[model samples]
Target: MASVLRRKAADRGKSLLDMILKERKFARSIVVLVFKATRLRLSRTSHKPGSVVLISAKICIKSNSFTRLVEAEAMVYVSRSTSIPVPRVYSAFEYKQRVYIVMERIHGQPLSVDWVQRSSTSKAKILEQLRLVADEMRKIEVPEDAGVSDICGGPIYDPRLPGRSHWGPFPSISAFHRQLRNGIVPDDIRDPESIPQDLRELFLFHQQLWGKPVFTHGDLSSLNILAKGDEVVGILDWETAAWMPCYWEYTAARDANPQNLFWREEVDKFLTPNPQAWEAEAIRKKYFGDL
Candidate 1:
């Protein structure tokens, strides 16, 4: 029954892709291979455009608010600065109030699916590679001429509400902290007033604990990381990527929930452990009350 439903969904995605191609006058030989709600739709085309191209499209409502152009631009920004692999953008545009992104379909499995089985030595090697990736990130200084829209927060693709479009491509770490304190999530926040007074202040106090802004993947859950053997082949889903406080990357990786025992024990191997984990937990506590 589940497989039947999945097949139906895939067919619908293929139909949607066909419509997109027809409307845009894009090549028609493309075939969709996968689909997911709020994630991405995967397809392949090998026609007049050039060589074989594997395209990943984010056209779902969960993705549309942020805009595909921002994700494409973010991927390009990181690809130019680091040896880390990312999908190349083919095109990004909007139709019917939906943002569509077509990019390289990376040919690797998500690290989350396989991390549990690897030996400790293999895990260490992978972590070393991740460390090198982080080192490359540190060297990427944000542009001096960048504006508020281009500052450290979610990409300012839409001028609507700076916080609404994305988690933040915020003006500063302090600005992000203010957003958290104000309970400005794009979706919903449960009873913001129920959060304790001191905890709210604690959240604000942490904002002053600053580091120079640096480039970050923003959300580096194992799902975003792709691997083949012990090496990470690509990192996907840059919709949340930003230039934020230096400690932001470490905080994100360490706070990621390890879904299994092996992953639980091995979580710290992915990035250098730091104080952001505790701070992040404190932030969560303020909003969600005891997790």
Candidate 2:
């Protein structure tokens, strides 16, 4: 019900409706709509195979879809930082309280769970590719007020939004734990609260370690990637792009769920163990309790 309503006194994630209406210049003339995946589109006209044009909105959730529009703009703004090839953004505009951007739609099947099943694919190759992207990503200097925010879209007021201030990390990990059981985590939670212990602690540690608001595409799962000949060609679905920790981006790249989180194994091996700090912790634990 709240997702359906307009901005009241308090709200965080900008209402898709209000954002478009406010930025009339962007949304003008453009009919606002959503994209669905029911029909099978074949190569027609000059468009190549698998070319994504437009579709109904039955499949996409409004929040993520709206976020994609923003990321499309963000992609253009940060074009220099993108390592993976992306469909060039043609234009950006908003309409009817929903925003949109025109882009050179990719003509390849997006990488999916099956794609991760690269047996002969050397881990070295994936790591090399990830490092290349990471190298390009680190070059980006996210503007202080640029694409930045934690993952949340409740009706609560987001200062980043038109009206509202956030405490911190809206839809906190505690909240996300309930919502996030897609891959490794199971859906039917037996001991629901059990998640709070091991994982939450690690999440908190990483949050502090990479707390600075930097830019990252939150939904960097396999499905969003495009591959051809063992290489990542396009990084599609920039919807969840926002300010986040530097490490967060890498963390996402490592989360190859279908094959277990091994794709990230190499990256994690290098990053997690800060030799000095790890040594200090070891010594401290030797003297006191490892708590």
Candidate 3:
């Protein structure tokens, strides 16, 4: 049954025991597990099929590492509020070589950019909904279950640097810059180094100083955030979740457009995570009328 289910999931671009789901010596799964000696199993599959019931160890064992992280995270936030939008988490347990996190399988539409494009006239309404989620999220407290050290991890630049990696691009900021300059990403704005000192500083500022540090969906890309008629129903893909500054995922990530352009429909000067901002001059200027 397990093998059959795994095969079925794979056909749908979803897989239990996915390639990304690393396995252990016992052929079981592992979670934030430090030592590989333990594995987890779901104790019970509640009949009603709500998130609280443990589905099945065999099934849970098939989850990927990223799923484990999300379940563990859900365990932390579930206590806060059921009203707010988020997947409900039940457990994070380890047994032999496996780790399992039980969660309420959310029932809602997944986020897609199609709606954002379709709702241009009502863009502000959509943004407002996003802003509300952000506001509610800012209120949630990090759970003691997941340790801070485990969540934030290490700093990228200068082992000597403080806190964490630069929010945008890191290790080699220049690589991202080169991509931007060479038109790696379409509709990119900003003029590399030639940018004014103030704007340059602002570009750098966004990297470091956007949002309040909280648990963030690090992979809050278009494909990850779900929606149903403009209402953000669920946030998928917890593999990239982390405790970090706020807007990096929420504000900056929510939209792929020149944010300044949305309001007043102006594209004055923009900045992205790339090393040099001036990569795609033609397209960038076409929107702004001038780079």
Candidate 4:
């Protein structure tokens, strides 16, 4: 009964907040006040300046020109389709070319914090839970004809990509690979002399690669994973979540931030490792810089 009552109260609060947010002047004022007073900020190296802030103990709002509604949509889809612990989104909308996502403020520290100091047993336990969460995420039904795309079947955003912009809702893995090569099709290169020998080999290698698209959290960095004790409490930052090639998850995890050097070794424990894919990604990154 207490749980039911609490749920009702939460629903009421969400409704009230929704109404409050609809008032542009009032919402702007509230955002300004929260920015000045809140201790919780969801700033990341990849996120635009002043994108996310905690509005209260329970609510966080991410709003900015770089914020996309698909991020909120991804969170909602994951919450409904899987048991992966993610922030509960209360409201998502857009006004004046900016997107706003109001969601539950999950209280936990990122796994990157103190991860190296944790005991071996604690690390194993966290990895076990993360493996289960990854499995559950893979079970989500893929949309028909889906290629590389966001949850809404739109272009996907990945800061690691060269332009730090939306890429494609490509119809096939081959099409997506072509984009990765900056539109250079290996078959179209009639004269091998026109391109560098190494570049030609890289293109050929990628052309032969094939995999069915699967749901992928494109950025599986330790900094994005929140935990309490040995339990993973939440997976934050779904902006880059999408349907991608099967090897993407492993490669993305392997490409951890420079600060998270330890996480690169731990990724294989929770996610399948694809050394070949990692090699291919390294070659691509060599030619076209990542971010």
The C-alpha RMSD of each candidate to the native structure, in angstroms, is 9.6, 13.3, 12.6, 7.5
* Alpha-carbon shift of residue 197 in model 2 (angstroms): 8.7
Index of the highest-TM-score prediction: 4
Q: Give per-residue CA lDDT, model 4, range 129-228, as digits (tens).
A: 9999889888899988788888798998887778757888898888888888788676787886788766766786777757668999888889999999
Q: Which sections of candidate 3 miss by over 4 Å?
A: 1-62, 65-67, 78-82, 95-98, 113-125, 141-212, 250-291
Model 2, 94-145: lDDT tens per residue? 4555555545545455545444466645444654675566566556675544
Least well predicted 10-residue stretch by lDDT in candidate 2: 33-42
User: Residue 160 in candidate 1 has what lDDT?
Assistant: 22
lDDT of 3 by residue, 193-264 (tens): 555555444445334422234555544444545667767666654544555443334333423434222332
Ten residues in sequence with the least summed lDDT for candidate 3: 263-272
Q: Count the backbone clashes (under 3 Å) in each candidate.
A: 7, 16, 21, 0
- Could you estimate the TM-score for every candidate? 0.64, 0.49, 0.43, 0.82
Identify the runs in model 2 with alpha carbons over 4 angstroms from their true place. 1-65, 113-123, 144-211, 251-291
RMSD of model 1, in Å? 9.6
User: Where's the lowest-lDDT run of ten residues in candidate 4?
Assistant: 36-45
**lDDT (Cα, tens digit) per residue for candidate 1, span 67-135:** 556777877878877788887664565655655566666677887887777797877888788778777
